[model samples]
Target: MKRLYQTVPTGCDWAVEAQGLVKTFGDHRAVDGVHLKVRTGTIYAVLGPNGAGKTTTIRMLTTLLRPDDGSARIFGYDVVKESHIVRQLIGVTGQYASVDESLSAIENLVIFSRLLGMGRKEARQRAEELLEEFSLTEAANRPLKNFSGGMRRRLDLAASLIAQPPLIFLDEPTTGLDPRTRNQMWETIRKLVNHGSTVLLTTQYLQEADELADRIAVIDRGKVVAEGTADELKASVGNSSLQLKIQHSYDMERARQIVEQVLKVRSNTSTETGRITAPMTEADRVTDLLIALREAGIHLAELSVQKPTLDEVFLTITGHGVKKDTAVDSSSAVEEVRV
Candidate 1:
């Protein structure tokens, strides 16, 4: 694989840029010619399935892994040639908590501050500020080993801020968190961007990207399949779907046949729920479906036309559900490597 990094256009202001990035491990090409542009002070999310090279792209951008071909830049600093400078301007939070279990919440942050070259008094003050900001002030003195998963995650994020980097890379920041805690983390990320910090997030949760990202890129098999705003991507797949809920389970197959034969379009049927979903390409399809169902003596309990979702767009592009693959669970740790 060969990766190339190009500078942003003369007038363009991008916090991150990649062009023709390629990475290979043995015969496996992990990242293939991925071109990305992330503006300053915005959240850019990379979304894909488990083995889709989302993590590999992040590693290349953060300067953790050298691409076999292509180039990447962080704030105009070359990820390969000027990696030290790039590292200085970025912070990263991996999937799992990276805090030292033996260290207290405050101690962990202080350690990072010290490593960043803050004086002892300055480091202590920075630690206190971050602990309070992350709502871990009350647990500052307690060891991280005693904290809940959410608390530990918060502490890990807070530690990443010790250096006050302008760019942050968050890899599955909310994975394994409860709904409430996940929302809280989302709020934190929003707050960071509000203060002019840029964030690049990679997540499996479509809802997370929909809520937090200013732009999204969907990658698969080491290549980018689609890139746009949520609504834009949804629109790419074309037309809404009319889902019909038949009165009886036995009527589902019959309804599907009618929809396919009459509408001249493929109909998707759910065996468990007795629902038939067909793409609504024409305005009269809904009316036609209802009339055909009635003529066939099939009672439809419910009917709805729904626009495509981000999940649907992902599925259409990848030929698979956006759900994570369980076989890659053990390799997720390897995916966390970042600058």
Candidate 2:
């Protein structure tokens, strides 16, 4: 009974690379000329709204789907040409849990271990270890049908790691979990990277990307629109905003005039509340605006500076919010209306 351990060298450099990767379905291009470079042993988050081609990109990289054009390499093996070798070095957790509902938590993991070529004893041992690590030890023998959503997600993640592949692709891994469970999952992901596993995650949650990603790539219209650290993207979209709430609605115009005079730019005035907001690109600009407001005798009931959010960055780049449909195939990316 030989133990099967992945012998591929860990932590060399970029664990996943996509060069001009393109995937099209019918007349629609799901992934168009996308390029990504993810460093080894790091978490790189791909963020966008639904149907942003994130899943398509992940499929091509994992060799689950073939690209119409270009190439994607995982651990230096071509995704299309060397798919078998690539598959051996990577693990994938798609949008839904792929575990067998009839099997107990431990049974599910053991099955994955066996599939990975581990002997029976080794498979059972690995399953038990993972069950404990993911805090599923108490429910080790419970069938997946009896498990909660969070529990099932943890088991799904554990099974992917049964082979301890160097690269892991997580597509919306925390989609349906509660806040506490989502935090727990974040901790688990952090632990994996600390242990030298490189993770490529696709998620619509901006905060998740901000918290976990070493770098984030924003895909819109089957293209990479922005790629940078959270702060970099925020800065690229420009500065924090100084929002002023006037005591009286009539004072809104006054506040706007003062802000515009001080900031030398047109202030964004809210029509509903009469609040005026000016973009503050520099820390000094905040002070300058405050001083100017005081000198102008413009009194603000409330004033606060807010750092640019990822949503703002997305809006700035695409001329619409990430929630909007700006993709090449607009109909495919549109949010489904719930009855």
Candidate 3:
């Protein structure tokens, strides 16, 4: 309930801007030619699989790691040259909890507030407020080592926001949380943005990106492959998806041809279900498609037009699914950068 943020500066339209950012770990180029621009007061997501340089990009942006090449700025201040100012302007919550394992949740938050120069009484009040805000009040006295992963993660974020920096960086904040806890985290993230903090969060979950990001940048193999709003990215793949099942398996090939001819798009078929699938730029065209199928005597058992999902968009652009294993662990690569 207490005021957490200083007045957000009006000097820059972008909260974060980077061009051609690159970082290499010996032989591996963790981040290569990565570019991004995060508008002030919005949730921008860096969507990618593990080892896709999402964390590396975040580290460079947060001033925790230097780029091997390229340039970055936080709120118009050069990340390399004005890192101290940048540090004062942003908060970072890494993949793992960054608090001491032996300290109680309230104690850890109080320490964070005290370190930020809050008065003793103010620090205690602030810690108690954060404990309730993060739903950790019940465990406020429990040592962090006794807390659950979700609880620790919540506290980590609470600690990061002690000063309510203008910009916040969250690297896979919900990686291992249960569905309910993940939803809670999502709400908390939304609240941060609602209260005027620019949030840049890295996420592997397609639903998380779709649910939270005002804009999304899809990264793969250390490069940004796609960038746009959720709808824009989905539109990149297709408008809507058409799935049709022929009443007879013998009509499968005929139906596929009819679909392509009517929809003016290539279509694929599954031999097992005799189903025809194609991308539809115009859902209205389905009326003509159905007429064509009827004229051909291809009775359909089922049909539906579904919006393209982030999963489809990701796969279409990256040429693979979102679960690739990588050798780089950026969370462990650097000491936790709390600010």
lDDT of candidate 3 over 1-339, digit per residue (tens): 343445567878889888889999999999998878899999999998889999999989999899999999889899999998888799999987889999899999998888887888999999999999998999999988789999999999998899989999999999999999999999999999998899999998767888999988888889887777776665555666788988899988888888878877666578798777777778789999999888888899999877655455555566442222210122111111111
- Model 1: residues with Cα > 4 Å off, grouped in runs: 1-12, 237-288, 296-311, 319-339
Kindly indicate the candidate among 1 and 2 with the higher lDDT. Answer: 2
Query: In model 2, where do residues sit more than 4 Å from their true spots?
Result: 10-12, 238-240, 244-279, 287-304, 319-339
Q: Tens-digit lDDT track for model 2 on 1-339?
A: 455566456545878878888988989998998888888889999988888899999999999998888887787889999999898889899888989999899888888899888888889999999999999999999777889999989989998898888899999999989999999999989999999889999998767998999988888878877776766555544567667888778767777777767666555677698677655666677788778778877777887887655555566556542222222222222211000
Q: How does model 1 score by TM-score?
A: 0.80
lDDT (C-alpha) at residue 137 in model 2: 99
Candidate 2 local accuracy as lDDT?
A: 0.79
* Total colliding residue pairs, candidate 1: 8
- Candidates 1 and 3, the one with greater lDDT: 3
Q: Model 1, range 252-293, lDDT digits (tens) per residue?
A: 778888987776655567788877766565767677777888
- Tell me each candidate's TM-score: 0.80, 0.82, 0.79
